[model samples]
Target: HSSMGEVWDEEMSSSMLGSRLRKVVQNYQAMNKYNVENTGPGGVASRPKLSGSELLCRLKSQVQVLTLTPDLQPFASLSWSSQLPVKSVTSELGPYKSCAVVSSAGSLRNSGLGKEIDSHDAVLRFNTAPTSGYEKDVGSKTTIRLINSQVMASDEHRFLSSSLYSNGVLVGWDPAPFSANLSQASWYNRTDYPIFTQYQRYRRLHPLQPFYILHPRFEWQLWQQIQDNMVEPIQKNPPSSGMLGTVVMMSLCEVVHVYEFLPSRRKTELCHYYQRFYDAACTLGAYHPLLYEKNLVKRMNQGTDQEIFTHGRVTLPGFSALNC
Candidate 1:
């Protein structure tokens, strides 16, 4: 098993990325798409670093896994307010003894982790990743599916007609401005993706499905924790859905075992297990601070390096399990 630094740095280094991907990471860094303004003390190098346990405690105390509610604006006055799930995500689908967070990484292709993933009381899958054919590799059970706004807003995904999304509880999120102020008019006016219309449309069709939109603050707060723990500035974009979903599970479950969110020895350039596409950016960071996010997860891992190598798994105690 490789050290965390060896695996992450080797894959994330400029020398490892092809020229095209190198340029893409640089371009996103320059874009600062979310208008992120770093107000924290310099970086990890500038301060005494917190141990993994301390970091975990801080996260348990500070990060709030919140979803949009009737109290929030736009939703408050809009027709969709009543449609929003009345229960918190934790109260609605949580407090599980064991939960699994399944990543779409290509490294999962031949790992044959399906049964183990399904063993969890609840399983969370991201975006449009499927399990029909690859059930041996990825579990067939999906208790919750977390989607980005792009999946809902883009017709290319066939969001309205797809059966993949219909089986599980659905949670959607969009990258809001860095301020993360839901009360501001600017936030609703300029979301990264115009998903509100599509979200409402889906609600009308499946009135009984438990669908929820994550509050924008959840992403920015999680992003700040990632930034605060790093030595260098990460990409200005919000954390990826993998990172967001991991935290969401952390909040709801007693234990979270995240599979392949960090690459295993089986790591490959193939983006998703079900897709033939290849891109290092999908594993590392291009638009999202994936590398940094992975590093933070590594720090908080309760599992051993051998587990990471063999199973591509990192086990974490949920907030309820933490003493803090």
Candidate 2:
């Protein structure tokens, strides 16, 4: 798409270039293991993977994280109405730079619910009580599946059902085979995430008899976020000129995003930043509701085209404005 009379032609940066920005595969290089930390007072997500005392002992150069520990309970049972709760988290080793802050309990095995909730916590808590400086956890996924049954390990997998009660129970899932209950706004449980679709497709190839199916229990709680959270932050809004125009925000998934300024000085500058942000989003694999908004370029000044916070792909009942 053309913006500010200029054309954006660059493509999304691949892992080859992104590798330098991130810690790489994390394993390909020496794993920068941090210390294990215990949950503070209040309900917390379980860290069965990392030992608390051991967690406290792994700090390398220094990385401070905000953790949620059960004050009276063992595991934090977040519900639909529950909002993210965090306070006094920032006083770390120094001024925070650009980086994704991870949860102390992130276990690769339980990637589904563990980091998901933490990501939600990152956004929810950041909006209210920001812990570290800079956008800490915008790359997080705001939803999670809760398992409270004793079925097979795979049985505990969470799938999006077709229908649901007010309490958020999965009655069924599909195109309704007639009409769809879900919309294109947000990504739902189906073929992509949680890896259930792959098994389902393969299983159908062999079955004619009753097949063993593992079911999951409990509803997922959506994370709270600003109504116009999709609206990218316009750094150096106006007045000042140059190539510093930028858009930045922390996504519900706890990822830090930066869309460089679209210089609209002439249509050329405007188009430049447009492609930079757009291409940057694409380059960064920003497919979520965050930077994935349609062409939301609006003219703020001569060289700056502003993208007012617009709509997102997903919408909940009470929070119609909250984007996916």
Candidate 3:
């Protein structure tokens, strides 16, 4: 039987909780930063992840071949499910022109990044993981990250952690292709974050895209098709006529100004309180995009005495992007 009192386990539950919370915060911050930069018309995007019967229509519509020459299949098949044979991401429709087949250089850099953050283990790993910038330059590269890895007493509390940008652009968390189930999956969408206000607004407004994207000049026609068929149907649906849901729509005019005011680079800050929104997300464990999902409006409308993670930003050396 469990009691309100602590049941002694050898495990450091609170410490682990703190560490996990930190991870959630850092990832949320990086992803939030990514949303701002990578989004917009004519920008790098996830391959065509059409869903439902529409996906079948798309499959029938086109056929293009992408060669598997240098071999990324073994790495790609990292997240296969027990029921499904082939790997599938809900939104990773591929065959795009701009994917960078990153080499072991990024992987090695990420591994060493782990070392740089852990102060106790920093010296040990620093000796082993050489910071070889010129392993092979496929032109300039960059990685933006938030790193919150420091040793401190229980009495100390920190809300914001460092945001790491190397060379010029924000560093991506050079993820291992198949290594999906680790910390990335752990914090799926816990509402412990303080950022629910932004999410709540997002849900109420329910924009067609995560952050409303600018239309691409080239693909404007096709883009409208996808947007009208897939996006608007879901996003524009008025909250089903029922009890007034907990979520309230953010003023559309305001959101439009916020999204449209972005600079031509399409890589500027996405929101007025972008930093705070992410800070709340990190403080709580809102790891998956779904935490900001509108479906949970009824559930998260009310508050919970939840836990939170601290934001961490760490600059990992050895890479930079050309544009950023």
Candidate 4:
């Protein structure tokens, strides 16, 4: 069985991350803030290694892309019953032939991929990554925008009034306690942010827009799949918005092209193309299990590494494309 250090070494081989970033990863692993417990031998060590195709099948069978249905709790018992959309996200906006998941990575700043990104049948972008000035690189189309609860709750983001959010089908997600039951009470009591209140307010303001909260169980289930596939435990925190957005697109589109989620040769210290913030953690991961998430996506990539290096792109077949 591979040790945690050994697995990190493997990542370092390709990432060429500096010692400081390496230390940050080790710190998060040691913290395991959410208290994930994986006491058995690692899944990869316990079973024969599965081919990428088998891994894709496993993901198709195991991970479910679910959104808050009106019938589910909290929202069901509350006034949200009438506000929530009757159709699932997939049913409402899906079955596209091709889609793009554009990460906010700084590497995209001058890649000149805007035209290509906009060509997809649909485009999925994360949080407040604007497509205004950067349309030369990041494209100007947004069919879906998957946001973290923090974004919905923050006054700084102008979640209720920002034109940035007014476009696209908005989906919100929050990290609940790792062990909490998927009940109305449990979820309301322990969400990482006060997203419920903001969500309700937004619904009242934009009664016509299609906005849905992602089922909390979806995040943890995807986290479990990530942990199960690896040789060592990742951070107990939830997957990044980028990873969750990728899976959501996978469920809705026939083929998903993810951009900059995997760093290209143009990788830089800038956290996002839109902001002046600079943090390697945004790419390598400090809070979210971003490194493991990237590795997992790389494993499932049907595209060539040259694409990853050149376009910062990774192509993944959507769940519907998988026979399993």
Report the number of the highest-lDDT candidate: 1
Off by over 4 Å in 4: 1-17, 32-44
Off by over 4 Å in 3: 1-53, 56-215, 218-222, 230-274, 277-324
In order of appearance, the predictions have TM-scores of 0.94, 0.18, 0.16, 0.91
Where's the lowest-lDDT run of ten residues in candidate 1?
5-14
lDDT agreement of model 1 with the native: 0.85
Give the Cα lDDT of each candidate: 0.85, 0.20, 0.20, 0.83
Over 4 Å off, model 2: 1-89, 93-287, 292-324
- Residues 1-324 of candidate 2: C-alpha lDDT, one tens digit per residue: 443333221211123335543333223213212111221211222423222222212211121222222221211342311111222112211121222222121111112222333432221111011122222322333221111111111332322221111121111111111111122222223312332243244234423211111111000000001111112211101101110001111211222222222211122211221122223322222212111121221111111223211100111111111232
Q: What is the lDDT of residue 69 in candidate 1?
A: 80
Per-residue lDDT of model 1, residues 256-314, tens digit only: 99999978888899999999999888998789988778888888888887778878999
Lowest-scoring 10 consecutive residues by lDDT in candidate 2? 215-224
Model 4 TM-score, all chains together: 0.91
Query: Which tens-of-lDDT digit does each residue in 94-170 have in candidate 3?
Result: 12112121111121222222332222111111001122343232212322111111211111322122111112211
- Of the candidates numbered 2 and 3, which has the greater TM-score value? 2
Give the better candidate number (1 or 3) by TM-score: 1
Candidate 1 TM-score versus the reference: 0.94
Write the number of the candidate with greater TM-score, choosing between 1 and 4: 1
Per-residue CA lDDT of candidate 4, range 1-324, in tens? 522121111242213558888777767767855556652344346765567778889888888888777786666787757777776777778799999999999999999999999999999999989999999999999999999989999999999999999987899999886663667556676677888788889999988888987876778888887777777667778899999999999999999999988888778889999999998888888788888888788888898777887889899999999997
After aligning candidate 4 to the native by TM-score, how far in Å is the CA of 95 from where it should be?
A: 0.7
